[model samples]
Target: MADIARRPFLRHLRAETTSYVQHLRNGEVRHAGAGIAFWFRPATAALAEVPLDDREQTLLFHARTADFQDVTVQATVSVRAVEPALAATRIDFGIDPRTGRWRAAPLEVLGGLLTELAQQPALDLLATLGMAEALARGLAPVRDRIAEALAADPRLAERGLAVTDVRVVAIRTDPEVERALQTETRERVQQEADRATYERRAVAVERERAIAENELANQIELARR
Candidate 1:
């Protein structure tokens, strides 16, 4: 059984876990798996592990819109780790810098990175649109743009982090700006209503004038006859 003794040990990886098997010989990634596995020598081997299951996350940050207005952006995101080893590189994994002991959780590290990534695109998109227009247009385009931007980023792909969906929970501006937009919208609606009423009144006046002229002409014809 000397041949069997020399072989690497078997590591069990569940379906919901992402795994990265590395070879210590040359410091190269020996294998990467999502719901999969690979064999490696244990003495010189270093393995980094992360969860592959779905995760829900959130972001609460402030960013300025195109109109130079400060706004608070709240967003919700769903993410899954596709490359646990790559993601592990980006995350500290709660390792103590001094002693190299574990302290923090993986989710925490992922959350911080996700928060930064999620906010950058959102802020960028918001900066291109005016604050009032952002509120008026709603969050559909904002969500789409953020998702697309995240998909295009090479770093996220390298880390094997997949952003499933991003949603803008709320975008809040200064109270004064909100009131100003409301007042402007109210005034515009009122003006349109007033214009419609004036048009209807003008049409009624013209109809009445026409009816009165017809009545007068009929009266004159009767008198002549």
Candidate 2:
């Protein structure tokens, strides 16, 4: 009876040791707090879904990272998961896990997306009527390319993973560009004002000339009478 009791304890210890070894091998052990999946929209942020089995608990992680920087800007995203397991794999590898299921694919896709985003002209980003719409428009080509690439990846297609949104969270303009735009606007306004004033003065002068000619004609008629 004592041996049986001791066996359970010994087995538990062995399991713990094995888990620790696996953790060390994995480099970082992501406790399954909540299984998360990511859905990256073509022109918006990445949406993370949690509870790999259920679509409801999915959380979106709006990821925005600046060019040439290691830091990422993340917001709480709102999206649903089409493939829970795939989404979970994306979150684990893309955000936290060093060696996750989609490790290579996520990095490749995200890196390409970020690089393409960075290459976009600042003016294009600012000149658009709506930031989100503009970003979506801009990302059309990139999205097509990404889709093709993902289709080529057997693993991603098998999981039914898709990127849904990719949008501009915020736009940053150069100070010089802003100042130049302001100056141009002011100059244009001043030009319009000057033109209006000149037109008014010309009209006044023309009216005065017409009145003077009428007066002269009346004087001539009176003198002749």
Candidate 3:
């Protein structure tokens, strides 16, 4: 009887709780999410998983407005590795394939890229809007623009990075700039109030003069009659 060659057995694979996986076998690589059983030669298969869930981080950036006033922007950036192969090649995944042992994790690479992409667009937008408009509109509008700019970037896609969410947490003026704005607002309000008071007093004086003239007319009529 001839000996028969045994085929590679099927095995179950589960993605990490918050991660995704690239299953590579026999010169083919497949991206997978969740658990699915598949057949692969144990010796030839490579399974790499990186976090799929977005990682949240805060970054503070400084940009000068068109008026040459400096402003501080605080933002929350949510990023994730979307392409398994690019991520594996670009970032140091801590686990050593042979040892499967703990290694000091590498710094976040995707986050840095996302920050770079977001910062310039934000600054450019601020330049167009100027300081007053930026402060007046607040972060909501800017957040949307930043997020859109990041999403539409082809470079990010090439690097296998994605910005899931970006929040303009706050945009702060320099302390001196803030005080100046506040003082200007206060003075304008005061001026408006003073104008109102003056107008009220003028109206009162006119009413009083009208009443006196009527009284005089009545007195003169009474005497003439």
TM-score of each: 0.70, 0.39, 0.68
Q: Which stretches of candidate 3 lie over 4 Å from their true place?
A: 1-16, 22-32, 35-47, 80-90, 94-107, 138-141, 159-161, 218-225
lDDT of 1 at 90: 74
Compare the candidates by TM-score and give the number of the best one.
1
Q: Could you arrange the candidates by TM-score from highest to lowest? A: 1, 3, 2
lDDT of 3 by residue, 8-69 (tens): 45344544456555567665775354333344444566655566667887877888878887
Q: Kindly give the stretch of ten consecutive residues in candidate 3 with the minimal lDDT sum.
A: 1-10
Error (Å) of candidate 3 at residue 58 is: 2.0
Q: What's the lDDT of the predicted structure labeled candidate 1?
A: 0.69
Looking at model 3, the pairs that clash are none
TM-score of 2: 0.39
Off by over 4 Å in 2: 1-80, 90-172
Taking the tens digit of each residue's C-alpha lDDT, what string does model 2 give over 1-225? 000112221211111211111111133332222322222221222222232221211111222223321112221111233554454444443221221222234434434433443333322322433433333243454334433443345553444444444333323234564466568779999999999999999999999999999999999999999
Candidate 3 has what TM-score?
0.68
Q: What ranking emerges by lDDT with the best candidate at the front?
A: 3, 1, 2
